[model samples]
Target: MRIYLAAPLFNDIERSFNERLTSLLEPMAHVFLPQRDGKLMRDLVDGGMPLEAARQLVFEADINAIRRCNYIVAVLDGRTIDEGVAFEIGYGRALNKVCLGLKTDDRTLLPSGDNPMIIAGCKKIFANTIELVAWLRGGFLSARDAG
Candidate 1:
């Protein structure tokens, strides 16, 4: 299955996290990352393109990737849901695509109230990488069967 991976991408830690995720998923299926062009958007922004324009480009690219994929694996571990990731999840959910959310952050670390949107949007959720991968592979298979 083709899977669109959505996560925070602006930070160094996020870049490492996404790389690990890509490696993990590579053995199972095709993995699509928004910044697949080796920081082309970042380079554009650095070269004086407005930050807003760069952000719009990334968002549009992510949405297009999500639309092209059959499933979404969203990383929901940051202090808050990354806006782009949230958007991808919502789009996938609306399309009736299999949605799996992985949270590296502990529940106790999340701020006060539950994030109903994330909970409702994801068909499955996992706290660890292994569990998430297992769930995603299974879920993708199930989705294929249902379709």
Candidate 2:
């Protein structure tokens, strides 16, 4: 299976965690980690590419990767879900791809809970990477069947 790991990648802590997660998931499936696999806006800009062109290239690369993947594993940590991650989840759903969530944080905007739309988008929500890995290892027959 090919998995599109959707997560925040703006800072060191987030990027490092994403790499660690990618390593864990690599044994189970081909993981398309944007930080590692796709074009980086910073690098492109530093290399003399215009900001707009770099942004476009990065966006297209990620969108194409998502199109080719079988699943989207979204990291739903932080007080609020990352905006880009939210967009990816919606896009994945629109394309009929399975969406799974990894929510290590307890914070939420709603007094009730995380947004229903977000919750409904995911086939399953894991509390940690271990749980997510375990679920993936089980073959995801239910997820496939649902789709």
The CA-based lDDT of model 1 is what? 0.79
Best by TM-score: 2
Report the lDDT tens digits of candidate 1 across residue range 1-147: 788888778878888889899899988888997656223477778899999888777667777777888878899886678877787888899988888888878643456634788878998788889998887678667977999
Error of 1 at 77 (Å): 0.7
* 1-147: candidate 2 lDDT, tens digit per residue: 899999999999999999999999998789999999999999999999999999999999999999999999999998788988999999999999999999998998788888788899999999999999998987655666778
At residue 61, candidate 1 shows an lDDT of 70
Q: Kindly provide the TM-score of model 2 when superposed on the true structure, using C-alpha atoms.
A: 0.92
- Model 2 residue 39 CA deviation (Å) reads 1.1
User: How far in Å is the alpha carbon of 81 misplaced in model 1?
Assistant: 1.5
Instruction: Return the TM-score for each candidate structure.
Output: 0.82, 0.92
